[model samples]
Target: MSEENTPTSKSTDINERHRVRMERKKEIVDDKIQQAQRKAGVIVITTGNGKGKSSSGFGMVIRAMGNDMKVGVVQFIKGAMSTGEEKFLHRFPDEVSIHAMGEGYTWNTQNRERDMEKAEAAWAKSKEYLSDPSIGLVLLDELNIALKYHYLDVHKVIADLQARPPMQHVVITGRGALPELIAVADTVTEMQEVKHAFKSGIGAQAGVEW
Candidate 1:
């Protein structure tokens, strides 16, 4: 047909439209990037009754380590089993400090006094990490569980979290995160449990569920 109506011309027109759309998107995204000028560490909470909450926290720990930042981790209710993250990060002792302070899950431990004692001990360790300016990221693994069961005072936990160094990032992970905690955090992510393997016949898998 005519040169203007050729198949190649139609393809060229589509490409031009796509390029124009992307150009606008790039400008909008660049403007947003520019608007976010303030730089500081933030409190992040990953909560809800789903998997990957702690995994996501560990992912950020790895990210911090990749950036050459020192990381500290305290397991609140997960010392019953050796997690995959703990095993892997143990090799990088210089970069990541791990403290599995939990006495085990609450149901298994079945002692409120012991659980409270362990929670307090864990918080004591966490305060050290929070106070140290050298640690760039601190992960309080399953901390929400302890807070939920009133093993530790939520108000005090939040106060300590707030008192951390301005440049020290924190990640708290577990189900039933307190509303007070969420209110103070800079970022919050709730994992929705659509399905779980334990609900079926499958058991927790190493590297995948640990």
Candidate 2:
């Protein structure tokens, strides 16, 4: 080609450099986003004497639901009692699946057999939810205490959860979590009891303690 007809060398070099730099940056950003998505299927377990374990799990459920994700909740000990959160969530029952064991806690029930029965039923429901790939998140509320008290088989629970779909997430909450469960969990949070009005002779308040 004639020198006058050929493209300017300086402009051509600058354009090639800009294209290379943009391609490299795009590749790096794509890789980082893929890594973040791969690590998304995590299990969060919270156990301690303090409150908010179940509350925190339900908060995640609410967030997922808001994002148009399906969520399942199995309350092991808490009965079908009317709590503020439950009452509020009941409005959108289609987005959330709640299976509450009709019986209350062992401390309140005072019946070992009944408590075990309730826990077993709730565990069965949780197992079904864990197996469902459509469920983006499963909240097993008060499951740790059920495991601590030998209400459900911990090994079976772990096996079922580990076998779930790669993108599914799980959250277990309650006091006295087993070490084996913690070892398998991706994130663990311990809420220590620092102070409480209950010890000060104040009764449990609605929408706060319930």
Candidate 3:
């Protein structure tokens, strides 16, 4: 067999090329990381028409708790149904304070006034948490939806978020995040749903959709 076609030779060459490429990539990544010297609390917004928005926020809450950081969670537009995250996080009462404040989706509640009231109440609680420097991470889950529906004032929310403690991270998750909020966010992620099991007639199941 030709030397170039030999299996061992080809494998060795490929491995060497991959190693060189990875080394170069690592150097570039390290330089970028080193250049990022400024450290402070970040505002992360997860919004779009897809799954895992709130799940991502909860995951961060768990991470913060694991690091012994105090976290506060205010869930908007999800009180009608009990979720696995709520149940699980509620167990850590000392580390995490969770509030699920929503009568349900707009369709289910069919009362804009009541929805506004709940959203306002939830925001009131969230403001308290935001002002608390002891809380390292504050997750305003589904607050975007409340803003989208005009239940809460986006300007006021932005002002409060901007005025939060310098080292307190905040995460807001929901669909249809406003442009003004996105503009002020430090990190913004938009989830896109290519295909969902619900479309295939598969209902939400425990430990997954909840």
| TM-score winner | 3
- Which lDDT tens digits does candidate 1 get at residues 15-61? 99999999999999999999998888899999988889999999999
Give the higher-lDDT candidate: 1 or 2. Answer: 1
Positional deviation of residue 24's Cα in model 2 after best superposition, in angstroms: 25
Local accuracy of candidate 3 as per-residue lDDT tens digits, 1-210: 899999999999999999999999999999999999899999999999989899999899989988999999998988778889888888889999878885777789889999999999999999999999999999999999899999999999999998999999999999999999999999999999999999999998999998
Candidate No. with top lDDT: 3
- List TM-score per model, in order: 0.92, 0.80, 0.98
lDDT (C-alpha) at residue 138 in model 1: 99
Clashes of each: 0, 0, 0
Q: Per the 3 Å backbone cut-off, how many clashing residue pairs does candidate 3 have?
A: 0
Better of 2 and 3 by lDDT: 3
Where is model 1 poorest over a 10-residue stretch in terms of lDDT? 101-110
**Which residue pairs come into collision in candidate 3?**
none
Q: What is the lDDT of residue 48 in candidate 1?
A: 89
